[model samples]
Target: MSKRKIHATDIFNLISLTDPQWDKHSRKFAFVQTTMHEEDNEYRSAVYIGDLEGKTIPFTTGKGRATSPRWSPDGSKLAFVSNRNEKSQIYVMPANGGEAEQVTFCKNGARGPVWSPCGTKILFSTSVEGVQDLQQDEEEKKKKKHPEPLVVEKMRYKSDAKGFLDEKNDHLALLDLKTKEISLLTDGDRDYGTPAWSPDGKSIAFVTNLEENPDVSLVSDVYVMDLETKEKKKITNSNGFYSALTFSPDGQYLGFLGHEKEFQSATLSRVWVTKLESGETHCLSENLDVEIGDVAIGDFHSGNVNPGLMWTEDSEGFYFLMSDQGGTGIYFGSLDGAMYPIHLPDEHVYAVSMLTGTHEAIVGVSNSTDPGELYHFDLKSQTRNQLTNVNESWKNEVELCKAEPIQFKAKDGWELHGWIMKPAGFEEGKKYPTILEVHGGPHAMYANTYFHEFQTLTAQGFVVLFTNPRGSHGYGQHFVDAVRGDYGGKDYLDVMSAMDYALESFDFIDENKLGITGGSYGGFMTNWVVGHTNRFKAAVTQRSISNWLSFYGVSDIGYYFSEWEVQGNMEDKVEKLWEHSPIKYVSNIQTPLLILHGEKDYRCPVEQAEQLFIALKKQGKTTKLVRFPEANHELSRSGDLALRIHRLNHVKNWFVEYLQKA
Candidate 1:
């Protein structure tokens, strides 16, 4: 049988695999597998176990979603979070296969379960509203009365993902498995997360901001608490952002990933290790040019976990994920600030789990043609053995396009990296319309990964061109931070140069029928591009920013993001902000444009789209606006499956109408 070309709706048939974990004995792997449920309009997830021989089976079953699978120290049990009861809670089940047991019954719910070193207790996090712990029945009864008004006082009162925030704060709690008692460990008005237990189980390390006003501060300090005396000591100096806490096997050092806000959000994250006894800290990746965490952006995978700083058994060195050039790879870093590559293949390593004492690991990887899967990798030999074929059937039935790596120089002779995907079933002598796709995070990299939208466009007879501009990661700190104060300056030249390079290098691209699209930061760039140039025939901007003056107060991160990114704010630099806005040059836009946005989007906000649409319409320009209800900023990635499909179709039809039709 012949294979069929991939389509936008084919996303429903594709499977996503993530968060692979190795058992204590390293005999089996537990990972999360998710698939689209068209009837329910949701994604169904379950935990599955597999061995080195490629034998895999479901560990958690039923309708509810399961994720964050972690094996106990003895390898006899597995702990995971599930929403089987309509509320997320921790559950435990035998590793060999048996019925799962519910462990927590908190009023608001719980998640992120971490087993103690002795395996006798489990540490989890839950949201606490106040000092009183209201009974579930009483809470439901009160909810049946009147709706309470939300009082907003802080700048961080709302978020794009969680929506409006309340007085509740995230706190840690301990569950005694033998006694069946739950005790709240930490409390207050501050939020706490990313907890790690010491080897002896006497101390707990967590991340939180203890500043007088945490709402305005972007600092996340690591603190250690002594369980016996309830004493706390801060590790970080409250200067930067820190996360992914891990203690060395020998309990001598603590490792984490962070940056000192040198370039604000565009700063490269580096690995740091602190001596526990002497309170000395050293950066292990300070001299390395690459960022020390996974910054590759993709729209297909869900529930992906980045296991940072997997320490070796001897505690002399550790393995971590780093973004360099155009890919995310595995690297080993020592305590003395030396780095070495363990595996630097041109593929995206989204998740990884190290087998404590050996040079072996289980990783979840994906490429341009494959969605994702798990593999057993050897550090010494750098060889990978297939462990699961979850997406094998889907891969065999569809024809996908492969991204060809392209490198070129910017207008100033600076090097740039990107990829170009030819249309599926391409012929040498034929011409094809090309679409320039921009990524959302000017700080995130466009790596070699399976992108559903790119494949769908190629299958529809359009070539796709995507590149890492100056602000993109994996290209060192100086390159990534170059676009901080200059949103449309040289960064604009870098992308324009990429399109120029593509037209000059490839003979099949039709320059007259060009189109462009992007979301978030990419969306902002797309708006900027169409305003400045009329070379493209069509354009689609998703969740994009149009006016910096309005964006400063409307966006969730705008109050600071505007200042950190564009180097202008509404208060003192109103003129500068308006000067850099796309609305300033709206009269120059001659291309037919389509605007797509989520009604509930707070990151870029729907008002941004509304403003741009009104400006273009007022000027008698050709444009259309389509908004997805109940969708947020993540509409293209983790939003409702139906809406995601609708969004893909809208983007495809807009370009087809302008470029392919007369």
Candidate 2:
């Protein structure tokens, strides 16, 4: 009898993947429960709400992928978005789980439903039929002899996905509860999203990226609008990217997240608070090295532009999350700006929503060892109570590795921070092959978080080392800003130092054999590392920047990011960009390099991989390029589940084929 080949589906089932949500009152919780079938294509899921007894009762599930569950103001109902009818639409259900009623019967779609404070209106942004309208309006204007809009030719006039988009815009809309009247908030050729409400329900706060010249140097600024008067006001004026806006409980102060034009990595977002009355602003978390990643930001590094900062009903202090010490955790910062930890310092906490009439917050807690779980943490008593157990069955079956935080001195004597994952079934004396994994943002950090890739690598008998180099976030602003115009310089040294430390400290790590891999910025680094040194036997670069010159013209934010990082525009510094291009050094690369890219990725398009591959192949260096069909830059994150598994498997195979004993 032949043994059945273990597939990614098998591994996925062996591990748990749950996305949980907390209610406004924290009395009930809703999360997606996934059950994979071994033989069938269909996957089953349910939206469940847990009661005080820790028992989760099923709420609704008939057809679609239901998620983003938000409780109504009174907690009598739950509003969620589902793709049941082949498209995503808002749906409401009773808290106890019964019949679900559909809302928002629109032609295009609806998403991100948030109920009003009075429980009367639900606010969400929908893509209107504006393109046709804009074209018609342009025709009418042309008939009336109006001037034509400027036709400035750019490299991205035709994108990889949109394919020749002359006019592009995203608007905001609101749905009235009783009348069911939909009102368009702002009509313009720009992108506006992340709508938030004020405490008194008098106004709405949102972020808008005004399309200036199509250079992708978008101005994402915070704006405010009076709900009754329809008066709009731009609150932030600096040349910085501002997002994640929220109002204080008393409605006197507004908080937002922003980063200057120089630091465009999305990994150095700093918290800014503005007094609504005086219009004066102060940087609250300026010194902390953290990136605010969001779904709107597309799961990059959404720190809390507006973290769980529920102001005390009295508005004395606000809650926020700081990801500095090790992991992302919720903390309480006073109105005077003094900050302190709310939960125990040992655990990593996030997604904190306040429970009314209590000194506690319902937060999401996980650790280097455990997957995420909702915990009710009391600031007054300093006690944590677990609320939901989404993955009870996989609790013991899961192989959670210990992330031993390590600090080493760079060759320049600057101290650097990193974390190492020992091989699964690790013994202090046994030798194991190692994989040096680098994070993408170059601005991002590999903190003490539970990552599937790290754990799976450990499970396969590999020690993994990931570090926060000089360019990585969660240090200080200076450390993050230090990477500007210094790519492949000191930051590279920081990573090299981390690997050196890992090789020396871990007796179980085999120094003779090693593998290297990274995505995006990490990918660029991997390409650079392989070209610069032959220490690693194998390397995989995912969604990376190879030729900086091509990337400047090809990527969505390439024009802006190149200017920000390289500190030079495309026209001004062609030689400098080429010098920073990883492909330039491919002649020296001897390691077996595997390049993974997405076909429709506009951010770091397939051309990047092509440039590196052609360079290496011409030089007789071993190389392979795997392109995922119909995938975007976020292949590892929001790509199809099966595709993500395929990507991981391919990476594992590439590494094992080159590094593992033959």
What C-alpha lDDT values do all the predictions have? 0.90, 0.71
Give a tens-digit lDDT track for model 2, residues 105-213: 6545677777888988888866655634311233454465657665756655655445345655456667777877767777776667888888788889888855465
Candidate 1: stretches off by over 4 Å: 131-135, 138-145
Q: Residues 1-662, candidate 1: write the lDDT tens digits.
A: 87789989898898888888888575888999998887888788999999899988999888869998988989999999999987788999999888899998777778899999999999999988753542145456466566889998899988997888888888998899999788888888888999999998999899999899876887999998999888998988988999999999888888999988999999999998989999998887878888998889999997777687899899998999998888888999888778988888899988888885778989889999998888999888878898878788988998889999999999999999999999989999999999999998889999989999999999999999999999999999999999988998999999899999999999999989999999988888999999999989999999999999899998899999999999998778888788889989999888999999999999999999999999999999999999999999998999988999999999999999999993
Model 1 TM-score on a 0 to 1 scale: 0.98
Who wins the TM-score comparison?
A: 1
Task: Locate the minimum summed-lDDT window of 10 residues in model 2.
Answer: 295-304
Best by lDDT: 1
With candidate 1 superimposed using the best TM-score fit, by how many Å does residue 71's alpha carbon deviate from the native? 1.1
Task: Please give each candidate's TM-score.
Answer: 0.98, 0.89
Candidate 1, residue 222: how far the Cα is off, in Å: 0.6
User: What's every prediction's RMSD, in angstroms?
Assistant: 1.3, 5.2
